[model samples]
Target: MKHLTEEDLVLLYYSEPEAPAHGQLHLRDCPECRGAAESLALTLNVCSEWVVPEPDAELGRSVWAQIAPQLEVQGGSHAKRHWARHLWGRPRPWLWVAPALLALLLGTFYLGRVSKRVESPVMAGLSNAARQRILAISLADHLDRAEMLLTEISNAGDSGAADISSARYRAQDMVDEGRLMRQSLAEQGDTATLALVDEVERFLLEMANSPDNANAAEVQSIRQRIDSGSLLFKVRIIESNLRTEGQKS
Candidate 1:
């Protein structure tokens, strides 16, 4: 029979009083394993020793004196408990609450400023002009993207295969984004912006739903409408006026 290993002896030494009966019985019957196990236990107990120097009888009083100034009187127990509750009880909930409260306060402050601006005719007019500038900027960006799409499609060779597919998808996405922006402008209750929204919506619809595979003629027509709208020039003028008004304010 193969003799039991040192690991078996160590396991028997530390295991619960009622570990495997067979291991216990082997340790009892095997003198060599029992001696080794005893030695291992002695070594572990020696390694675990900790030596602490004894303090003088005055040490307790000295420690208490040092800590007394830092300790609050019993009357402050309620205050300390309140502080502990505030610090640890529901930190995650407070973490969420704090940001939400801050956001609400910021929103309230912003709305108050906006209300003041809206109540002033001059400021309201400038705000309307600024919005028109943004709409015009959005229109210009849409047209630029559309123009790029047309250019890509035109340059695609006979074997271009799916090269222009990504461009077409991007152009379609621009159309959708422009439509949503125009809807927002319409909701702002500004007649000038509403009119521009109508014009831009019509243009974007034409580009988005053009013949399955648009031809050069259709591209040219779209380009002509973009130029006639003078969208980019209008954007620049409105933006300049807004900047001037902002500086004055």
Candidate 2:
């Protein structure tokens, strides 16, 4: 019969079945196999008797250092192996540092772009609203000043020509402001504002073109036009409405 192997002896020493049936029958019948198994058991027990020393913390680093060279040879690429080596021992400062700084800088740049994009719509809305408010308030103020001018013209004393240059200059200035407002309104096809501005424009142009020093006849003629058009009342109402709308906006 063939002798049992060292493996069979080890299994027999541990009482592990090497075969399901007639297991170790040869070992039981043969003195040589039996002796070999007992000898293996004795050797194993003697090895177990030697106390294993506990490893220190440095043992882990020592083991990785020992394997690092073999890993580098198998890893293939010089750059990749260099990076992997950094994972075991003290990494060169720039290895992790440069990549971390690059990531942070990229993150900040992308974040700034996102924030500006996110805020654009809101900022645009605010700017448009502010422009509208300014236009509304300006138009209201212009109307208030024009209303005063027309009132003065309508109620002027009939005494033969005083220095009417102030009123004429004021009328020319109003015309200028009114012309700009009218052009803007006309472009938008605002028929209502156009109508009021038309009435105010006629008064302003007439006053601006009339002689600097005017007679009672001219003053009366202008008053007649103001009364006929109800220009003052119309401007006052429109100005009041615009101011209220501007406030709400």
Candidate 3:
């Protein structure tokens, strides 16, 4: 009464040619394996619907090409499959892919940043003024997005769990994107700009960590923080300054 492993179920789910030969036959007759497969399928469908920031096409393709072979070269397929099935085949098999996907995303993002630094020749001819203007424009866009996140949270009056879930996801992305911008501003010795970005980042992080079904009190607390700091006003001031700087050249 051996059951199919998570790897086997995943392979069969995707109809990979190398999947275990009897995997389908076993699932047809075994309720346990079939249930596992269904859970895995549901998780996969949810993952497919995630709205992630689109990376540049060429950069994504090049990075994928360079790292794709490493995925296959890790261990002998038979040995890896055996280990995956034996030790990792307990409950919630879909959870196993979470860490792997997170690592892959982080690795890809790190490499993409490094690649831009390596390809600095693309911006080598730009004058200092031109670079400053470009930075200003980029900062402006970042502030605009951050402002929108704040507005959403402010206006989410009596929203249900679903609205909270959507806002949390968007807040998470805003927090991630703000990290790089904050670092850039700090390095440029723009303390005023850095402070505003830092403030917005903190607010975004709070929203990201809020309970999925945040209660009225929790939502109002966040709004109060926004009002107390005049955060939206400060953001608008910075956005206006950046726009003026961007228009200078």
Candidate 4:
């Protein structure tokens, strides 16, 4: 039996028109898929209670005003036009996915805040155990992905001038997610976990800033940094502990 992909589950979760009816049927018939759907629902339901702040209406226009002039001076009319198309054109897959992922991470942060400051009955009803499980699951998943990316780079043995644009893109997302997790961990006063996230964020920042096609030396440098600090080992250790906590919760 074929399981529904994550993308399929996400679309189904949102009740997007694009989601096929068979997905709902399959979810009912397949215990694995049903469990996966339930997990997604749990996370989303918890996050829905956390309110995200609205952005300033002028923020986008203001930032554009600052950068538009520079774009023209640097690349002339063609560059500015290209950027305009890229920004305002039909949305790309990454464009859609990035915002959702960011919202999920931000939701984790806001959820923590709401639990502390708000006295709403709905918020009060969510058990502390539930909250711990959510945080543990989120952090464990984040660290697992981070570990995979770092391991890939570290094991890029002697591959000359590899195209690492994919890794770079992933690193950029990780950097954003890591910062939110770091903020959440700090608020909870988990100093040890906070320190690990700090180190991971720094390394992820370095990866995010790396060139698309990094040369052998650049690759080795990243690997050395990861290895020197034993970051992967530490991430795995914490991830294992989180999984245990998540299960117990």
Cα RMSDs, all models: 22.3, 40.5, 16.7, 23.6
Model 4 clash pairs are: none
Error of 1 at 186 (Å): 3.0
Clash count list over all predictions: 0, 0, 0, 0
Single out the weakest 10-residue window by summed lDDT for candidate 2: 72-81
RMSD in Å for model 3? 16.7
TM-scores across all candidates?
0.31, 0.47, 0.53, 0.54
Error of 2 at 68 (Å): 78
The TM-score of predicted model 1 comes to 0.31
- Identify the runs in model 2 with alpha carbons over 4 angstroms from their true place: 1-129
| Model 4 C-alpha lDDT per residue in residues 111-152, reported as the tens digit of each score | 656786645444355566666666677677778778878887
Candidate 4: which stretches are off by over 4 Å?
1-123
Off by over 4 Å in 3: 1-119, 158-162
Cα lDDT of model 3 by residue, 1-249, tens digit = 999999998899899999999998999999999999999999999999999898786998897886675464221111123333553474333322322333333344456577865434434566657766766766776677667667777788755322476667667766766776666566568998998899998988998898887777887888898999999989988998997998895
What order do you get sorting by lDDT, best first? 4, 3, 2, 1
- Kindly indicate the candidate among 2 and 3 with the higher lDDT: 3
User: What's the lDDT for all of these models?
Assistant: 0.50, 0.64, 0.70, 0.73
Q: What is the alpha-carbon lDDT for the whole of candidate 3?
A: 0.70
TM-score rank, highest first?
4, 3, 2, 1
